[model samples]
Target: MTPFEPDRSEDLLNRLKQDDKQAYEKIYFTFSKELLYAAYKKTGDRVIAEELVQNIFISLWEKRQDLQINNLQAYLFGALKLSVINHIRSLVMENKYMEYQMLTYSENHQDTANLVDLHDLSSIIEEGINSLPEKTQEVFRLSRYQHQSTKDIATGLNITEKAVEYHITRSIKRIKEYIKNFYIFL
Candidate 1:
């Protein structure tokens, strides 16, 4: 690879600021590989390094009009270092979160893989509701499923609004208790 000549890089950056395509290509050819290798040395990941380099160039291009890059290499390396550090820190945090979640799952007793089907769970819940006394079922369906206001349902059913409120609250508490134990296992 040809060494990056500072004079040429400065002239190219100036011309690229004026929207010259040739200058842009010359800059890309001269600096892309060196910047990639520099970033990769810090990141140890080709994909992340490549992405950082790409972002740096795009940022440079966007700010070309106001850029005063006395030393192109220094400016590029500074940008590369910042980008790589940010990427690595994020990766470290993500790995820590995954490790913690794995450990939490292992300590729980239930076999997550043997959990009942979600569809079956829903069917079982509906069947249980259907088996309730007729009055409780009507109040449960109106408040929970149909989303009717208790006051409106009480007016329509000619019962006290307190009775409607009591039935909905009890049904919701029962559903919550049932799901809580199952979810902890998962």
Candidate 2:
């Protein structure tokens, strides 16, 4: 509404700090929609925007007694902005981790690629591949050889992505063992 007029706001704030449910509901109904719109404009995700606003209200209620504010609108907007930045930072870190995983497990095979002939190695790798059960072998090939994402492999194979991950892990462990033993004897 019109910023809750100062006298009413002061009364509501006092009730809120005292854990009055109706006062909390009053504040939520007044500010939540506007906060959601502001958050959506900043984050460009409707679901995340809604979540941020809900989190703000929850935090407001939990820390109501500790909060002191001359302008409630300013406080809510400022808190939403900080929460949005934190969410963006978390997403960026998750993306970087996925990229790191892809690069670490990439097909470059750096160490042995330089020391061994790929033909000999491929044959030894083939031995490891042949040893796997059929379904595990399929998932591993899709993930490693074809460079398909776990999502893609899961969709293509009609299996859960977690299942694809398990198969990839099982196959990689078996193949690495084969390669390591081959290196030791050489």
Task: Point to the candidate with the largest lDDT.
Answer: 2
lDDT, candidate 2, 1-118, per-residue tens: 3555777778888898898989988888888899989889989998678767877876797799899977776788899989999889868865885576467754667555444656
How far residue 28's Cα lies from its native spot in candidate 2, in Å, is 0.5
> For model 1, what is the error of residue 22's alpha carbon versus the real structure, in angstroms, after optimal superposition?
1.8
lDDT of 1: 0.72
- Cα-based lDDT for every prediction: 0.72, 0.80
Candidate 1 per-residue C-alpha lDDT over 4-95 given as tens digits, one digit per residue, 9 for 90 to 100: 78888778878988988788667767788999998888888875676678777767777888888887777878888888888788678658
Query: Which ranges of candidate 2 are over 4 A from the true structure?
Result: 1-4, 107-186
TM-score of each: 0.51, 0.55
Error of 2 at 101 (Å): 1.6
